[model samples]
Target chain A: MEEIQFWIGIVATMAFAVTGVLAIADRGVDIFGVLVLGLITAIGGGTIRDIILEIPPFWSENQIYVWLALAASVATFFAESFFTQPQIYRWMLYIDGFGAALFAIQGATKAWMMGFGLPVGPVILGVITAIGGGLIRDVLAGRKTLIMSHELYAIPVTLGCSVYVLILNFTPQYAIEGSAFCMLGIFAIRAAAIHWDLHVPKMFITKTR
Target chain B: MEEIQFWIGIVATMAFAVTGVLAIADRGVDIFGVLVLGLITAIGGGTIRDIILEIPPFWSENQIYVWLALAASVATFFAESFFTQPQIYRWMLYIDGFGAALFAIQGATKAWMMGFGLPVGPVILGVITAIGGGLIRDVLAGRKTLIMSHELYAIPVTLGCSVYVLILNFTPQYAIEGSAFCMLGIFAIRAAAIHWDLHVPKMFITKTR
Candidate 1:
């Protein structure tokens, strides 16, 4: 189980780093800037989660995550040409969704381990962990945060997190299986939303006037 | 001493909330959006600080911070007309500077109390607690972060924090007076920057090309 968690974390870090590289590729930023963005995108959510959970930041405890993110970012910078392909862009979206799902599940699990019995705690932590890094990336790049839009991004994470918390609270024996199921559920919903350009209803959006 | 800290925290919350309101006033966001922005701006820094220090978030422990921020934001929303005057704008900047200084000192003190003996720890925490909230606010609002620019903001907090940490380490008896002096130093420097539109030299800037 620990090994599985490790590999999932590595894959998610690399995928998120690639997303960050792709995000800033068109901005004409330098190599250092790209690396900074990549690191933030890869670890921002988990870092925020750890801080809020009163635990040492995950990357700060293990240097491997930092190295993996940096390596992936540098690799992505050199491989920018491949991302120009439309199919690769689609693949990136899938990878991003997968990473978000993995992160959301892990976030909820950590909250449970910390004895956050309140359903709201895990759900909120899960959503923040899934989207916080991307939100930071968008903010630094002066782009609109996905959550601020009607985009169907945070909803899947919230649902998956809530389900995981409920299962963990009710049936301890099924925690691992429940986690896997929730992760898959989130990825499927996110993939569908990406493919169909799905969004929340207009009435749900808050308007200024 | 506790009483002083309480009032400073309250004033800082109100000032930061007002700054948040002013930031989003022209964006055409609704009342809810404004309140969200305001609350984030007011508590974002301290929350980040506590999280990194492995302590529970300060605001979560006390509902007063939340209430104060909400009241300030709502008042600012209704009293937007008063902010049109140039003098009020100037006063707000001063208040913001004062609050930043106060927060920086308190952040350093908290780090010291938590046994952060290293000079780097307290200084980093102090700077983060002083500027972290505003950074979050800028990111959420799609504005460029002040720290990323050449603005003479974080530098003052860093210097003041370093001094406070140094004093607490070498001369513990003078810690209280030293904190006040450092706080004043930070506020004065920030006030000067705001008055003169001061910034670091262009030579230090990183160019994309």
Candidate 2:
């Protein structure tokens, strides 16, 4: 399970790096700038997660993550035009969903493994950690961040995390499997939402005006 | 001196938040989204600073900082349209200069007081902290991050921090005063750069290709 989690994180890093590179393809940013964005998008969320939990930043601890992000970044930068096609956007959305689900579950599980109590802080942090990198990427690329969108982005991660927490309370032995299931559930929902442009109802929208 | 730093931070926060809101003026984002961007622009640098230093996160200790960011965000959201007229972008550049100078000094000084060593690490962090928020803001807005432009942005902060560090080394008695001078220097240079479209020589540009 631990090995699965590690591989999942690596895959998430690759997806994020590629997404970052693709974002800047239209902007004609210098190569250095493009690579920076890609690497930042890849490691940013995990870095924040580790920092908040007072652990050594994950990228610093295992050099593989950094190298992987760099490799993904370089590959994406060179191949960006191919990935930016409208048809590929559909695939990108699914990949994003997969990455989000994997990160959300892993983040929550890590927090729990660190001896954080259930039902509150760790769960919130998990959702935050899962989305943090994407938020940063959107901000850097000059687009609307996930939190501000009407889309079902954060909702899936939140639901997955909550379900995982519930499962932990009921069956400790099956919690890992439960987490993976919940993660897949969130990913499927997100994929569906993207497929149909689904959003939470307007009534749930917090209006300041 | 501490009072000056606090007031400067407040002013910078307001300017950054306003700028963030203005950046999103025509993007069709909701009030919450605008607010999130504003708050992120205002406090994002300092948060990065705290994280790098391994300190208990600042906002968690005193929620006032969070409230201040929120207030600035709200104010920016409502007032942004008024300040984003055609000529406004020019004025914004100078106000942004002010923010850069203030944040750079405050960040460097805080790192020094926190016992981080002299010329290299803290200085780098100071510049990073100073420009970090704006960089993130530009990226998220789908524009080129200002720092990536061949402008004199990071240079001013670097020089200012060097001046401060020099003062701390030779004239410890006047360290605080020297830091103030450093901020003034950064402000002056930043203003000039905006006014004149100044940039460091091409030789300084790193070759990534």
Candidate 3:
């Protein structure tokens, strides 16, 4: 399971970097901008989580992630045609979803253990951990993030994180098992959403009057 | 000077919040989203800085800034026309510029004192402190931020911050006077950009060949 998690993380980082490269591919952003966006997307979420918890940025602890993102971005820059493949794009989504789920759970667990903002804070931090990097990426590239697309992007992660937090609150010893369970569950829901084109029902969505 | 700093911080918070509210005003985003953006823009930069420095967020130290941002966002939500007025918009630019300059100086000084990444890290942090929140705000709202607009937005803050850091490196005693000088310098450049439509020269622009 640990090895699996590591591979998922690697896939997530490269996937995110590729998407980041693609996000600004046509924007005429220079090479520097492309790399900056890629690195930000790959590590931005965990960075926010660590910062919110008053810890050194996760990347600073182990610079491997930074180097990987840079490598992926540079590769994407040179081989845009290869990365733009439809098969690679689809596989990357599942990889991205898996990473987001684990990231959300990890973030929630950290916040809960740290005892920061209790009750609602851990869940928020978890969601931020899952989606924050993508949000930063989209914003920098002026693209519409899945978060703002009124889709199922944020919901599954939020729900999964909430359940994970609740499990920890009630049964702390179940953290490991709960994390695995929630990770799969979130990924399943995300995959379903993508396959079925699911969205938040009208009642749950806030409409501007 | 202390009292002046206090007032400037307050104005800065309010100014950022108002702009936040305005950024998504026409996007059909709900009131909650507006307030969230407002609060994020008001404190996001310092939060990033603190996180990078491995400290509690500055807003977490003093909740007043959060309250001020909330108030400004609420006020803007109700009085959209008032905020959207041309005169108010014009005045807000200068106020925002002033706030950004001060924020950059403070950020640079903090990083320098803490001895983070030396020689260059503080300048980056200072620029991030000044422009980070606005970048988040624009990204959230899917608007073209001043940073990406090619108008003289980040350059002044970066240059001013570099100067301030240099002063701290050599003449630490001149910190106060140097800060004041840089503040005016940044604001002056920003004002000139606004008035005369200054831009980064074409030679500096990256072309996608």
Candidate 4:
């Protein structure tokens, strides 16, 4: 399970890094800029979480994630021109959703291990950690983030966190099992919503303004 | 002195916000994007600091800073083209230097008050707080920050932090007075470096193979 979590983290990092690289395909940014975006997409969340938790930044502690981001960025930089299709945005969304889910679970688990002691703060911080990388990617790419979208984007992670926290409290022996289930649940929900364009109802669409 | 600090903070916020707006001009970002960048540049450092200290975020308690950043961003957005001269960069450097110095002093003082008697951590965090916003701005803008430049940018703040910490230990009563002097010292050094294009000696310049 620990090995699975570690591999999932690496995959998530690479996915987000590729998303960042794809976002700036035509921006004429140099290699340095591309790497910066990729690194931000990969490590920005964990860095924020570690700093907020008053720990040494995660990337500085383990250089593997940073190297993975760099390698993925270099690969994407060369492969960007091959993405001739106009569905680039869709690809980005797919990759981003995958990364966010993996990160949300990993982050929550780490926060729990750190003795955050509550469902509320850990859940909130987990969501922040999950979305933070992509948020930074969007900010740097000069695009709107998924958070600002009309879709029920942040909901799945919130639900996953609630369930995980509840199970952790109620069944300590199955905490890891519950967390795994929650992680997959979130990934499925988020990916399906993105794929189907599923959105929460608009409170303003029915209004005659 | 307190009044001066207050005005300095306000002006610093305005300066940082304007810098963000200026960075956004080339990208043709909307009102929301511009405002976000401005607010990030204005309060991003302090946010990081508070989080690192495990304290509630400062801007949450006082919404005035948010309003100020919003107002400045809006004003800069509308009046952007008018300030697109090359000299704007020069002005930004000076304003940023002032802001960095003031924040460095304030952050160091706060850390001292929080009883982190060791000079190393507080002083380093002081410099981090001072330069963090600008670093974030550069990262979001896809531009290299002044820190990566050959100039003596962050070094001045480091020096200022050292002096402030020294004063805190040696002459506790004069700590406040010493902080003011250090602030001016940093501002003067940074302003001179910017004006004169002065930089720290590059010992590694010859090692570029």
- All models, DockQ values? 0.17, 0.12, 0.17, 0.06
* Top lDDT prediction, candidate number: 1
What tens-digit string does per-residue lDDT give for candidate 2 at A1-209?
67877787788778877876776667777778777888877778777788877788877878887898889888877777777777886687678678888888878888778755444435656776777877776676766667666678777777788888888877889986898799899999999898998986664443333
Interface RMSD of every candidate? 4.5, 5.6, 4.2, 9.6
Q: What tens digits encode model 3's per-residue C-alpha lDDT throughout A67-124?
A: 9999989988888888778877667666777778878887887888887666556786
Which digits, one per residue and each the tens of the lDDT, describe model 1 over residues A56-134? 8898889898999999899888889887588987888888899999999998888778765355567757877888888
Error of 2 at B79 (Å): 4.0
lDDT of 4 by residue, B1-209 (tens): 78878888888878878876676456445454565568777877887777767775566556567678879887887776556666876787689789889988888887778876476767977887787876776666555676776777789999999988999888998976898899999999999998988898887345557
Indicate the worst ten consecutive residues by lDDT in candidate 4 chain A. A200-209
Candidates by DockQ, descending order: 1, 3, 2, 4
Off by over 4 Å in 2: A1-44, A57-127, A133-151, A155-192, A199-209, B24-36, B86-94, B193-209
Stretches of model 3 off by over 4 angstroms after superposition: A1-47, A54-113, A117-126, A133-143, A150-209, B1-3, B195-198, B201-209
Candidate 1 CAPRI category: incorrect
Runs in model 4 lying further than 4 Å from the true structure: A1-131, A135-209, B27-31, B86-89, B204-206
User: Which residue pairs show collisions in model 4?
Assistant: none
- Name the best candidate (by DockQ): 1
> What would the per-residue lDDT of candidate 3 be over residues B1-209, giving only the tens digit for each residue?
88988888899889888876776677665454566678888888988898788877776556688789989988887788787799998787778777888888889888988998998999999988988888877778777876667778799999999998888789989989998998889989988887787899889888859
Judge candidate 1 at residue A120 and give its lDDT.
52
